[model samples]
Target: MYKATYFAAALSLALFQSPAVATADEITILAGDLPPMFNADGSGREAEIISTVMERCGHTVSFEIQPFTRHWKTYASGTGDAVATVPVGMPLGGHQSDVYIQYQNGVSFLTDAGNTYGDLAALAGHSVIAFMGASDILPGLKDAASSFKSYKEVADQIGQSRMIFGKRVDAVVGDGMIFAEYNRQLREQSGDLMFDPNQGVTFQAIFEPSSYGMNFRDAQLAEDFNRCFAEADAEGAIEAINSAWAERYRETLGTQYLGH
Candidate 1:
């Protein structure tokens, strides 16, 4: 009878301590504040994708949004459990997950400028402006800058649109979506930026797509993310999130957004 009682207690303890009853972990993710992709309030498409995938993996998620370059520094200093939007093969230490997002970087010039960039080489001898640290972040950009008439990088991406609209530069180089978002803001709130937002702009896909992923401090978390992300993607949830954001841009920026 005592043996039976011992077995019952052991079974109860095992049941109580089972993985099925384990509480979900909350993971804090650090990301860049690139709107329409990643926002400070954790409401952007990338944020939604991360939240959805992590939730599917039975984990709660939070975000700490910083500047595009600063987030890498924040991650390096061990500030968060994970960092998103990290380019593949970046030197940051951690278990990197599969490439889950892509940023389409390109060169934008006035559609009326009669400008056509078949490739990065075509950008030669043109005054160009790009996001801060772009030369370092973008492959071959440093070498390409040497041939441009003039090249500069700005921390505030809104300046990319303003500089191009104000005729301060021949072109702006960055993500098409980010540039579109800035243009949308300029159209709504020109303020002191004296430039014609109505002017047609052309985005030339001269560079390769920027593939990004997440890095997790825990290898198990990275594996779990990969599994859950694949599962969510198979269910079409990931594509739905992407399409919803693209539709928002389409409504705001017209059919020109995303080559649509």
Candidate 2:
């Protein structure tokens, strides 16, 4: 019966080594309405990457999208599992986690007509608009709130656009992608208005070149995700996702920033 006993031990070892046990854990990802990265529709490139990687590792995954600030608060409160698409160089606060993805260069500036802004210094005397909680990304501008006007809602983009057209604000300052997307939507609603990117007169990158990644509440899960993300990046899956969305954005919006 020695052979039978040996077979039983081998089977037990195999069961213990299987991935199923690890997958029994669930991972909830908290995200914001950051496009091309984390979309409210669950169709962002980062979401796809996370799904592919985590699924292969046998973990069930889900997402909750809130405002940028609220997403961080919820994750920080330890009410959920993790936060995804956090901008590079931003503090994680209580959520000490690993980086899972690195996005390419992104710019922030005003777009008027077909023109784009090339420098932020040009906006020194002018009023600039920004989101409520994005100060960390634009620390200099954030501290100079008195010099520039700020808004707390996403609809502020529309307000700023109108303000620019009406000469109420000197210029709008925010994520280039968000601004482009907002402008495109307005163009659809009102057929006669043209945004000359050429009208984008003043520009500046308050933040340095940065990337984004996922943050986890559990260190073990963060390790697992990092390993999976690296494997996917190596396999060209991440690149494929970015390329697919880039093409789609260009086809639909005629701009790359809108998709991101």
Candidate 3:
């Protein structure tokens, strides 16, 4: 009976020590319009991070980009599993769950020169250009949206560059990466126009330092995502992801703006 006991103990150990298998399913991620995070090219840094973690966790993930207001509405309606770039501890209108990603949202100014501004108060009385539905990114500037001397959304980057060249506004305030990337692409196709870092035009300000994470409709999904995210973070995957994008942005800017 010693041999029998030994076999039973081994079996028990196997069962107890084995890692738990995660459920395989497609998870829908809702996100607002943000470049280098969830862009049209599908090369967003956060998108890659989520994809890597979910794949390792035996799940498929997809994203649907919409306006910030609409994204919140859809998530709150309980129709999807999670929304990206959500502020932590955000009171859900109806949805539930606590898992989230960590990041910050801030304002970036693009001007004729590459000058940096420390805060919103610095732009007092200066005309600023921004998109109509970017309140989530620039909460303080929302009130001044109408008072601005100019405003326009060309639905793409080309028109934005044109507007900037035409002096529609003194500067543009929006996602730094988005504006930078778009201008980079524009300068590539046309050498005449370029972003000059030495022009003293670009400035970035952190309106509110907040954590961005995925909000889940169900607690189980949140738990799973959190587990996968933590595992990925421990494995250094998150750092790698950020590094890759940072390098790309630097390269892009170096080539387009710095004229390197």
Candidate 4:
């Protein structure tokens, strides 16, 4: 009887000490339709990274691509379980994960323009265009741009690319990859021969890289994501994805660009 009792206690302890398996969950992750980063076809750097991290944590993910600004509204309306590319310290009641990606934002101008913006203040009298919500997210942008000859924020980065390449704007501000992709698109389309798409441009690294994270409505999922993200990051999975995309963009644009 004593032997039997000891065996039962040992078995109970063993069972209690065993690792728990996470129940698989279907996670809907809302993202913006940023090409080469978050695509509508559910293929991009962020898509792959989110999939890798969620699957590692025993969850399946589906991306709902929306406009850059529209995704925030959709997330606020309780449409999805998580949102990606959330800026740091945004006022939202959700569990935020570690920084997953960073966008290199700065001023871009024609290489032969012989002009330089060593600082945001230097752009005092130049016409500039930027992505939507740039003033709200990027500190000092609105203040500096207030002094510009003209400054406009548009939802379509493709337009930004066109304006800058056409010499219609003195400068454009946004992600390097986004601008490069749009420029490549302009080159492919007909009837845009007025401005050279292949014209060399230089990006003035004036702004610090903008870091972003994933926000999850479910606390438990956010916890799992953080843990799994750390694991994947340590394994260099994120870097590999970033590197592959960077190479593809370099080939596509025929120039080196900021890789995510």
User: What is candidate 2's local distance difference test score?
Assistant: 0.54
- lDDT per residue (tens digit) for residues 1-260 in model 2: 00112123333332222121123367777877766566777767668888988886778788887865567555555556767766543455323345555533233333443434445544455555655434444545545555444333234555555555555555566654445455544555745554432233333333444456666655677777778778877898877876666554452224433233
Ranked by TM-score from best down, the candidates are 1, 4, 3, 2
Model 3 misplacement above 4 A: 1-24, 93-114, 133-161, 188-203, 251-260
Q: Which structure is stronger by lDDT: 3 or 4?
A: 4
**Model 4 RMSD in angstroms:** 13.5
Candidate with the larger lDDT of 1 and 2: 1
Q: Which 10-residue window of candidate 3 scores lowest in summed lDDT?
A: 1-10
| Model 2: residue 90 alpha-carbon error in angstroms | 6.4
TM-score-wise, the better of 1 and 2 is 1
Q: How accurate locally is residue 200 in candidate 4, as Cα lDDT from 0 to 100?
A: 80
Candidate 3, residues 1-260: lDDT per residue as tens digits? Answer: 00111123333332222222224488777877666667865558768987887787787987888854467556655545666765544544323333333333333344444544556655555566554445434556656555555444334644554555555556666554566666655556735543433232353534443346666655666676778888888888877786666566563233222121
Location of the lowest summed lDDT over 10 successive residues in candidate 4: 1-10
* Candidate 1 residue-wise lDDT, 1-260, digit = tens: 00122123332332222121113488888888888788768888889999999999889998998876567666666577888887676656677899888777777888788888767788899999988767866667888899999999988888788888899998888877778778887888836656687788777666677778887878888999999999999999988887777676563334334444
**106 Cα displacement, candidate 2 (Å):** 6.8
Candidate 2 segments whose C-alpha is farther than 4 A from its true place = 1-26, 87-97, 101-116, 133-136, 142-155, 161-170, 188-206, 251-260
